[model samples]
Target chain A: MPGSFVPAVVSRRRYQILGIIALAALVGAELLGLSASPPDRDMGHLQKIMYVHVPAAWSAFLAFFVVFIGSVLYLWKREERYDLLAAAAAEVALVLTALTLALGSIWGRPTWGVWWTWDPRLTTTAILLVMTVGYLALRSFVDEPDRRARWSAAVGILASLNVLVVYKSVQWWRTLHQVQSSPSTVDPAYALGLRLNALAFLLVLVYFILLRYRAARLERLVEAQAEARELAQGEELHV
Target chain B: MTPGSRRRLVLAGGAIVVLCGFGFLLYGGIGENLVYFLTPSELLARGERAYDTPVRLGGQVLPGSVRWDAEALDLRFRLTDGTQTLVVRSTGAPPQMFREGIGVVVEGRYREGGVFESTNLMVKHSNEYRPPAPGERPQDLYRTLLGEERS
Candidate 1:
């Protein structure tokens, strides 16, 4: 049975190449963002923080979207692979959400004169971070694979619905946090740096998710092998 | 249709209904619970109901209406939306950027005397960047710390 499974060596090599590419992109992105981008007319040097803050936010949202797709597929097809993908995406989304919040706060202190506020956009984002953390925790407390997959999939789907609310919160309510900044709203001079960082973050996200999914599959295979050995021992004792 | 396919269709339909119901409830709850920021005119338009409930009053600080007592930590100002003005009373050292004509959002409740008692005062500025005025650089504000480190 173990031999029937796909060899790990090939996948490990693929992950290594991906990891190196991701690291290179991240380093290049930082150099370009820190040096190449001119200072903003309003925010000055502080605007440089946008390179990290915005990309982290975009990646976090992208991760949640993956979770949404994974959850839906898991429910429809009852596939363990879908559950693994959803779990992987949720963990990544949680980390990126935390980074987004931290960077935004750091940016806020100098600009908004406060470290944090209860503005709609900021508040909803914090809620999203907490909810995703809860979803990951739910996955941990359940030991049975099928039960865990079913429960967490439902939660992943529901929690991702909050992403829409977080995105729309600024428009739905009057918030101190500024509305989403896009290329149209941002100065043309800043666009290149932002796009570069966004691409770098995206590459890093893809690498992390693939690595996590592969790890999950390996763990599942090990568990199956252990269960099979236990069953064989029981049969020998009965004989 | 096969029984399995029919069952799946029913399950999907049920999930959609449940999700829609949850969405509606969430929307209604947020609408009622959210204390939206309003200008003085909009708050007044709500009449007596606006009194004592938590509200975020946002507008420019009326020039010449600011009164601050540093020792007492009492700050008073009038916020205006051009058409109407409301007095705000707060207790704190105003933020370093607080100034007349700048936008501010005060979180608190309006009292019977027409004063908005703000528990928090947040200074807001336009997004357009401008070079710091002479002597107002962030580095200058931390000169004492930098001097200590240098020594």
Candidate 2:
């Protein structure tokens, strides 16, 4: 609480820098992936969709991991800031996860000839997306801040475990979805583009999480101020 | 640790344990049969049990085994897993990227005859992506690889 206000003031002045950097990185990465990478020998140009979809998945996982960490820390330390941080990451994670699913669906319809499937990898990931929406819904339904934070932290920890299950679904079960693609798995020609886009998406995740966290903190501060003013008025009336 | 933190820790641990148990049951109850699809040999091993009911069969398309009639929408191919092979027949057009040696999962039933009748065909692509060499653009190669010509 002591150092919180100082950083809040500083962040207010400089947060736009993060947004600009994220935008520039994203544009450059898209260009590199779309132009520099060659067409696949098999799927040809359709393979280019991986540049966006894979990175979206990666950023979503990263955001969810942050939510897990924030939840655990909040439960252990009983801090209000950690709960706000987790909620912000959860929101960003939801967006990125939805983006990943949409991109995958668009790519799938062309290649797999279906918009959706009950494959293990796809199903588990869908469950994660649904759980995230439920987690956010749970937060909104609760009124008391401490109770909301406590219960949501508990739920976040539970749902975060699904991330590991979803990541391993392809390997653990024979799925329509392919296994993880990395430098060793993917061709050398396309690896650089994937890495660049992944870096760009990571920046995007950070920007969104920080921006949301700042807004949440400001909202809480205003609410606290209003409550303080009401208490002062009550005391003056009693006097 | 304070009593409150200790209580929180216990609550978190209990929730995790309960969740894991639920996950295990879900996996054991349904995941045992969810291989997505069975290979030629796996389905064959099932013998009479694999008949009538819907089944998903997956394997590599054996080279030179594809037959397609665009007008009739009849497609037939032999799927193999190196150890065994089986015939797959469907009434719909196969996917664009369906080529010899590409992996596919076809869903239907092993009818009275030998063929595995597929109601739905899904392509399972490999993770690798290699660009065609200078002379062989995908557009040039695309026309010949659409399951009509044996490559």
Candidate 3:
């Protein structure tokens, strides 16, 4: 067990700093996102949904990355903190994924003339959302900390792998949804703004995950302390 | 693998197969409903063969091309994308945003000589907010005429 990595508990001041950073990033993302004039000659005001929908998708993917890393750490070190972080990230991912789907649907209704379609990226995103929800449900059923961490870590790794496959599969298959626009394909003028928007969103996502992870750690510490207090009281009664 | 892990693996396998298989089917289904967008010029470029096929045409609304008959409840307008033009005829009222130079999507079948018989007409607008250029204020001429008809 030598050199096994242990979770470093986050201090309160560091947690508060993370919260402030996340708030600042969120404001920057919103400002940059709205500055761009939506694409001309189609979709109209509804095109603005792209700002929220794209960022939500980005954050969901980021959270899943955390889940993957946490799973690996838990497997290698057998530390329960990794599992708790994975659970918190999964919860946030589920919420963001759901929002992504809802916003995509709203945008689709005007452009595609349909509220929902069986597009490859859409289907994959929906599946990923469902899997994250199922992982959260599984976490709720397990009682033993070690056993829950072990089982969920396995689930987290598997789900993260599947998300990668889904992303790749969409590219391989020709479908209703258009392929992702990249710098090479995009006009230089448009790509510059998009790249900035993406970077800003990423910063926000990183800050949110750090804040949530610290909160989860603090919650676990409080629960442990409460249990210790109950045990001491029972021993005192016996004495 | 533990019994629970074995079960989870099976569940995972089922999920993958269902999701991938469904995705495959989705591609096939949307293939038929996948309407390719075309500008008026593109549609005209294709010639008479483009007729009788479902097509979506996007273009700017040409000013002075809009004509309406209130008693008959029929309306006609020309959609142009600078290089080409197509006439759109509809019995129902167009979307509120439908105005001169505003972009639109017309869906239905085209006929010989490049006339699109539209079953549906949708107005499209630029997402940018540079503001309508000076002298480009939208006029509700259609609504005004319709009001004059009822009066």
Candidate 4:
């Protein structure tokens, strides 16, 4: 059973604790962000969507940053573990990016009068998502483990570079999208709420990535064990 | 180095060069041509070059200038960047949040008469978000959007 291949980083008790924490954080953050914050003066209740949308976009960027680090380490040290970690991070990044775009589209309808626009900020983000899909596809297609890790690491590193472009696109060009917002940029009333929700989403991102990483490591362990068993049987037969 | 690893290195190098070329095309080539929208001042600065061409004009809706004929589905307003303003005409139901003194981007042609024949009208929302004050209404969101507020 795959149960025997469970990695130390993925102990049952730790997983349960993290799962519970993530759930509580998500619930508490949503409650505070939606209920505590008043309706935005201009956007009215539409601003409440930011509690989920902004945090998801931020978390996706964070996940891509993790991918960048893992890919860099894998290339430098030639480590399979780093490749697996990067792959797991990429999967989570894809999900979060999709959620970010979907949420943005939903918010755009009522506020912007359209579902999408080819503005620099929107275009760059869509490109980032496509690049991530290519990264995952490249990993899956390569047959050799070492070659797969090396090539995927190179792609992962490059793909993550686009995250920076996505962040800066609003400022670099004239677009319909608004510029970046932070505590210093927005009002104090919203700044605090955004920060709390971002932290809560961070917890959720960490839990999902670690869980995916654990599964990846277990699959690799099972593959190695099977290979070792086959080699042992061949040696005994030859003897 | 073994022949295989050397080949791998060469392949990686090639990939790097190709990606760099692509990045150049992205930011250098496409970025220059892909002007998403232009402000009223910037577009008008083009003078004769701005007329007859399809463009997206972005700026705030000048307060007290909005005219909507719901029966005719005709909407018109003066779009301004404080220093420069242009009249915009559209034929559609304005968004639910459409109001005066808020940012908007209208897509269509800039005719010779200085009216923007807009086929598409979109709101260009600011990033700032302030909670509604007690008893404050949505229309009163911007206390002073008369070209003085940075946001």
In order, the interface RMSDs are 6.2, 4.5, 6.9, 3.4
lDDT of 2 by residue, A191-229 (tens): 989999999999989999998998878878777778889
**Would you give me the overall lDDT of model 2?**
0.83
Clashing pairs in 4: none
Local distance difference test values of all predictions, in order: 0.79, 0.83, 0.66, 0.83
Report the candidate with higher TM-score, 1 versus 3. Answer: 1
Each model's chain A TM-score:
0.94, 0.95, 0.84, 0.93
Q: Comparing candidate 1 with candidate 2, which one achieves the higher lDDT?
A: 2
Give one digit per residue, the lDDT tens place, for model 4 in A84-149.
899999999999999999999999998899999999888888878877877787665554678889
- Which candidate model has the greater TM-score, 2 or 3? 2
lDDT winner between 1 and 4, please give it.
4
lDDT by residue (tens digit), candidate 3, B1-151:
6887777566655655654554454456434544346787777777766888887777777888887777786778898888777888777656544566766677788877446788877654343333233454323443464656543
TM-score of each prediction = 0.78, 0.88, 0.60, 0.86
Residue B16, candidate 2: C-alpha displacement in angstroms: 13
Kindly report which residue pairs in candidate 2 clash with one another: none
Worst 10 residues of 1 chain A by lDDT: A1-10
Which residue ranges in model 4 land beyond 4 Å of their true spot? Answer: A1-6, A233-239, B1-25, B45-49, B133-135, B140-151
In terms of TM-score, the best-performing candidate is 2
Clashing pairs in 1: A41-B129, A42-B129
Provide a comma-separated list of chain B TM-scores, one per candidate. Answer: 0.67, 0.75, 0.71, 0.73
DockQ of each: 0.17, 0.39, 0.08, 0.44
DockQ of 2: 0.39
